[model samples]
Target: MFWALFLLPAWAVAGSACLRLCLAAVRAAATAPEAAGDDRALTLYEAAFLSGGPRRVADLTLVSMARQRRLLLAHTGWATVVDPRGRDEMERSVIGAIGPGGQSRIAPVRAAAAGTEAVRGLADRLVGAGLAVQDGAGSIAAGVRRVRLAALAVCALAALALALPVPSDLPDRLVALWFALPLALTLGSLLIARMEVHPYSRWASPAGQRLLTALTRRPGAPADDPAQLTAVALLGVHAVGEPDLRAAFAHRERYLEEPAAPGH
Candidate 1:
């Protein structure tokens, strides 16, 4: 039948989406985190990286230093070194990122600090510990991207099928409905992923995510401390409950925070 011509690409779209979803499942299973059960409790830096990757870690450091009177974070989006001496490697990285002038916009500082060796080393440790996704297509985030692309493919295929000058007596509604099946397949998969994977899929492995929930939910949350690094680490600047703090980090530059694509 002439209608079979459009049907072929429709099948291709469905098949492609199915294949990609299957492969993603396999990868997710392979990477599924088994809790280490040591209860060692992640450091603030570690938790920051797991929660929102490098930028979060950098933010935690900046906020921590600011609270300790070592840095000044102005609501107008500037960072000034109050105490040039950094308390740790992470703080030192931020100081260096601020450059020789010791004063810079928060955006450039956040960007540079996020790309530092300290952040990469942190990512490596978390990846080794099964706490964060690898930064590439093998990751769940990448799988989602591929599935989205497949949905687009379905749309394009459907368009081509409609554009063809085929002689068929099929009703216009039926013809349109015919192509909706595969498109729905791919879009449906995305919806399922959003429901199932989402927040964890972005940056953390299952075990890490579980631990994070526990830590934040526990009595006297690690964040409850006066320093509050844990809060910022887990929830970004919003955790600070300070409008000035939020505005300071809000001017973040969109570069190098997560370099190897959206898999995180």
Candidate 2:
């Protein structure tokens, strides 16, 4: 009982510190300009080539026309059955722009009953890219934790050694090994995690490389891009009562340029 009481405050303090660290990391990541840059690059890439800018408008018009003709049916009221022929036309256009890689070559467009997969795929790519800086920040937090854990382990071993009247050679060796091995691994992991790979980093044309990455990650419809795009669209539609695609695209660009709030 006495030992449990003595340990309670330590546990509380550690937990509090962990919470504080997590919150601080997220806040720092969210406000960072680099994180926002990822979003801008993705939006521009998609607008120029993939699903959003002109093609989506054209497709929507086609879909609307089809719906009016009753040649199409609504799956649930939220979606209408899109013509496979229209999909083929779009695929040809995409192939002309990017090349013959099927859905694998297209960065955002994915197969779905209605084009929901394609839209969602575009959104996911944007969100994932935006998260690069955040991931880096979290990695930094993790590195710090690793260091702290190593320190704590060392301290604990020392305390254990001291508490034992018969200080065996085995205990000292075990403590040394624990400190040495984990310290090396932690440093390596931290270095790799901290490597700065900007989310905004794009190709010369920007579309091809991004698409390739998307394809490599997902070989199926409903790729990450659409998911991300949907999120942004939903936010715009719900929060501001306007599906301001241009504004949504610009939001990321402006955020990226907004000088990372002094220190972070």
For each candidate in the order shown, give its overall lDDT on alpha carbons. Answer: 0.75, 0.35
Residue-wise C-alpha lDDT for candidate 1, range 195-252, written one tens digit per residue: 8776535567666677787878777746434675677888888888778788777666
| Root mean square deviation (Cα) for candidate 1 | 6.3
Name the candidate that leads on TM-score.
Answer: 1
* Residues 134-176, model 2: lDDT tens digits: 2323433443564466446544544554455663445555644
Count clashes in each candidate, considering only residues at least 3 apart in sequence or on different chains.
0, 18
- Model 2 regions lying over 4 Å from their true place: 2-80, 85-264
Steric clash count of candidate 2: 18
Q: Each prediction's Cα RMSD?
A: 6.3, 17.5
